[model samples]
Target: MTGPDRRTVTSHLLIAGMSAMIPARSIAATRDPTARTRQGQAKGFVRNGASIFLGLPYGADTGGARRFRPPAPPLPWQGVRDATRPGQRAPQPGIGPLRGPFADYFTGNRSAEIAAMPETLGEDCLVLNVVTPAVDRARRPVLVYIHGGGFTTGTGLVGTLGDRFTVAEDVVLVTVNHRLGALGFMYLGGASPDFADGNPGMLDLVAALRWVRDNIGAFGGDPTNVTLFGESGGGIKVSLLLAMPQAQGLFRRAIIESGLYPDPIAPQVAADQTRDFMARVGASDVAALQRLPFDRFSGAGTPGNLPVADGRTLMARPWAQAPATAANVPLLLGYCKDELTLFALGQPALFDLKWPDVPSRLAAAKLGLPPEAAPGVVDAYRSVFPSDTPSDSYFRISSDASFGRAMVTLADLKSGQRPPVYFYRMDLDTQLPPGLRAMHTAELPLTIGLSPRADADTLTKQISGAWAAFARTGDPNHPGLPQWRPYRPAEREMMVFDQVSSSGPDPQAAPRAMLREAIGSGAQYNPL
Candidate 1:
């Protein structure tokens, strides 16, 4: 708990004594724990009964010419590679600890969790961390988690959550680190032949799944029973993978939590942004752009730096059509009720917003709702949560417009396919500030069994049990929780996770209808 925060670590590294930075208590040394990956042997350690492996590379270094292209396979190594500590994260814009009104909300007011954010970063960041009951061939259900940072920041290190999920659920927990921001998603096909393949960030995930398919068996995982799950940006990645051909048969199940990007950047828009980026960086040619150090422009990011609907890697936008290719994969998707509260924390005015200002504020949020229709949206939301304040209603309305509607559309699109679809909405109160009710990422720690609240153990058992059940079979329903029904248009049933979880039909009907009327489409505006 006394360890340096992310900013402090970076500051120490910036100074000359980085080599002398204090380290955490080391794990007891025992050379008996090992796993043979296809690339090479991995030397891990035993902790609380699980074999923990950290920082195993699934792809080659993506620094110079390989920056914007498809990932290459990691070369084979001769001897055991040490995986005792966390791996390097992809270079991202902000590498410091957050210090504002938003920090408490994002970190759940946990100093240890904030300090656990990995400090080391580099371009060769396509690594994964694994925690398993053992390295034997037991064929446990594999749960691969992708971290969320809005396609910009974050790494795959699972921290305490990884060990908890692995041991409690008896599953192999694998967390991955892929390219973020410009390095992973920037479209350069319109500029040169070498960068024709866009969405290298997405490609990095596909490569990781392939690695799981090939090498996970050696680490006591059932390659055929891999379940892909992520939250926020990581959730968006899980959603995008459903439509990708290369990611088709890599996994058997998918779970998306608050990760709906209704609008991926268009190819032309991505190209325009690429040109602007080149000009801003003063690089006239592709060669010059490639030569610039990653830190020089790691902070440069735009909306255009998202996944592109290029004809090849990604044929169309995710959820544009029924994922016919992934028809057999059962899906579990949902979002927090107050999804936008985390983003709203930094703004003081939002806390004191009045009823008359609701419409303008909603319109200003740019959730694709027309300005004239804002009043009707507010009225609709008021009808649902009759006692909510104007500020509370504003947050709920905007969250539904951006996240709730898209999740409904995706569930609708994936409905009636060969495989079943399950839906839910996280409504658990975080016991934080009053306005941050069931804020974004509140379900993560609880579901991963690392929540600091002593009272959350019961709900965590039910939630994490459902996830493990889904990974084991196709259904999320288990004896520990209520009977969760597959989503059907007629019933529209979804499990609502809270202090006392229950099944419900159309929890946000009024506001959903209003947003659909206003925007004419159910999907738009994904803010991470």
Candidate 2:
């Protein structure tokens, strides 16, 4: 079954670019549990004692000619805006089929999550939510999260993380929704000079940051102390924003949790996808394309939405190495112990493979190495894990090749930065099948202060505290954790979070090196 096919997805405004956008007084507006903005007023209710504001517009609607253009400024209203429910998610192909019996187990939702989503997928999808404990605090550190989906699926879900993140940590929490899929990122630049700016989705994030810089102070946050964090695709975005000059100074700190460094799609690759989109929609020109309804454009069978290096919104190379411009920004990077189990456990195709099949399968997908080198990589992992079955070896190597390499590469890039870059490995095994141990996104709900449980109480306190401390002071050295030294190339140190949590030096060094030797430097191109 295809993952997130044709489906969905969705920062900060640059301080320099947005100086005259919103007034300075707007930053210090009084918080009455009800707040006022330059555009209008919004009343956020209390939940578990935290104030909550849901679905306030941060950017203008994307419809008609505005579709696929850089996000426009939010249109102002005459009356108070009612921010009660979540804003509509970006238009997307729904998460398609799940083949295996335990497919729902892998996703952690049988059908309940899809059932819970709003029925409407609207065009005006640029809105955001804020949760604060008390509006009384003058300078709270802010945590603004961009939801994951690899630029394809996931919404900026609304919640009251206030009890956990805001009240306990005293940091404000903000979640945002931007455009996604073909709606936000269809590359029509070469064909239509009018649509030349390539990264509209990234720009949407910039608009949200602009909103935060001008408005978050009133919600009890410091616009100057904002830290952007996300897991998976969201984490990828956090890293991308770090390199973006347009998003510079919008966020002072960043946490990249299990995110791959996405290289912008090459021009021909984007052109092919655009050609497919145009053919599917029967549009000959960009004007005719914009005239079509959103549903028709949304339905086009196309590739996953990824960014492009048009030299405007993004550099020619997308994080080919450490980002030179944003190297000064403090960063925390990490991934789950079994990052791909979130996908692999449900994939019988991988689990059911025989030893003879592994080489051809790896070659077919070009997972890490060519067919001739697959045996060497398999042996490499066997030397590393030792006890795992052949299938387990395949999955582990794939995980390392994709996400694990990205983590180490980022650590390698930022090894000596003075501002400091931190690294971690989440080894927390779950109650699910052992093969699904510490799967992707396993740390999200608790780490961000979602559902609270007595079992996860200690874990939550530790992980959340590290995140909170990092946001507050750029160092995650709270009393709860081991002294997490800044990652270094020689030692390759990283904090490993598990039941018996501890810090280790070069935990996966042997395996990462093995793959690097086999795949060469091209290993950095592995899609995370």
Candidate 3:
């Protein structure tokens, strides 16, 4: 069957099981429940005592004129919308042999997940998934999550499973879908008046937040008490949102994991990149570019896309200069140990290099420490990690450049503000692959309590509890776990989350200190 017909068949099959599985509960009953949306009036399941509304449209399709532009509101429908199943994924450019331990994480389980993905590309990609404990009118705190994929790939559905937070903390969890890559971040600053801006993906996020602020009460969530949290690219998006004026009052708290916004692309740089991308695709105008095949716009050959400092929407560099508007929002920021290990696994050349050659290679990329700090940085790392090899140094260097330094930089900057700042180092290793280490995104399964292995259950429970507690209250401190103190300049206390969690002054002291000094002193590492 053709794409459209296949989508219709899939939608029909998904909706068929909705009625039998989702029993309606009375509004006044102890188990408060309600309909999904006006169009897809499908009832939600009471799994683990929480009601879920899946694939609820917050904005209309981005087809034709709508593509590459800001998201538009969904059209009003006649009846309850069947929000029983997930909506189609945003159109992604297909390309390359997927690399690394997390390649499948991005390509998704094609046979299982993408087969159910919506087939057609359109303006209708703006939708959200929500899980809440009750549909009563009582307003519970809400957590709006944005997923991460280096600004090129990923969906909210893939990273989050809201059952733990919703049922455990009695909070509402909302995950949103937004434009990515070229469609999201193409800067048209000098090209056209209308397209003369950056961060279209971020704009989509703000639109989703606006929807939450306006309509979340209907789903038993408080519009005013919202927390924005994400991992990797999602975390970077949160950092950008923290700096955005439009997103200021929409969220009260923020959690950033393995990402920060210190190295936003300058507007001129973004425009130049856009020019190069257009040249590659043979498109002279926005209209011509939009008309190209969606695959041509998205595939592996597509240029890297990220939020740009457009001067208007994005007022200033987020990590470098704190937005005056976001100065007061409480922040929980952190990174996973061995974050770059997975990314480095895909590039064997990095693994083959000699330990002594590591510093020179970094210096060649302008990411070297000052001559004074270079030997000390290497020595400090080696002193702590006696058996460290070139591969380990590669992981350490890349991790610090892309995620670790960024995390510390943001924390240090934000610590000077009013609202308290907290940080952690996630050391939980996964069972997926040995070489993966405590790689980036490994903390996700644990934080969301989705790990299927019996061995990981204890860790999952602890981490999930901490996250839920933080969602419920601004603080992440729980009863059984060691006290996770706020990140203060004096003590610099950080929680080390592992099989046996601990809290003290900077566990990775030598590496963290060396990285902080190196980056502060003009080292030029690439931000992932």
Query: Which number leads on lDDT?
Result: 1
Let me know the TM-score candidate 3 reaches against the reference structure: 0.84
**For model 3, what is the C-alpha lDDT against the true structure?**
0.67
Q: Please, what is the TM-score per model?
A: 0.90, 0.86, 0.84
| Candidates' C-alpha lDDT | 0.76, 0.69, 0.67
Q: What is the lDDT of candidate 1?
A: 0.76
Candidate 2's clash total is 10
Write one digit per residue (lDDT tens) for candidate 1, span 121-212: 78888898888988989999999988777777776664333465678788998888888888888888888877778899999999999999
Instruction: Go through the candidates in order and give the clash count of each.
Output: 0, 10, 24
Kindly list the per-residue Cα lDDT of model 2 for residues 399-464, writing each as its tens digit: 677787787777777665667888888777654443455667666655665433446557667788
Q: Per-residue lDDT for 1-528 in model 3, tens only?
A: 111122221111111100111112223334324554433344454544677776677788776787777777777776656665667556664322222323233222221222223323433668887888777778988888787766766667643344645777678889888877777777877677888656777888998998888778888898888988888778888988888887889888999888844456788777788788888878898888878766676755465466777887775555565567778788898987777655553355665678777776555434555545665666677777777676676566656665777787788888889888889888766533435556777676566555435565666677777777777778888885798889986678898888788998985666767666676756335434
lDDT of 2 at 388: 71
State residue 350's C-alpha deviation in candidate 3, in Å: 5.6
Query: How does residue 377 of candidate 2 score in lDDT?
Result: 74
**What shift in Å separates residue 200 of candidate 2 from its native position after superposition?**
0.9
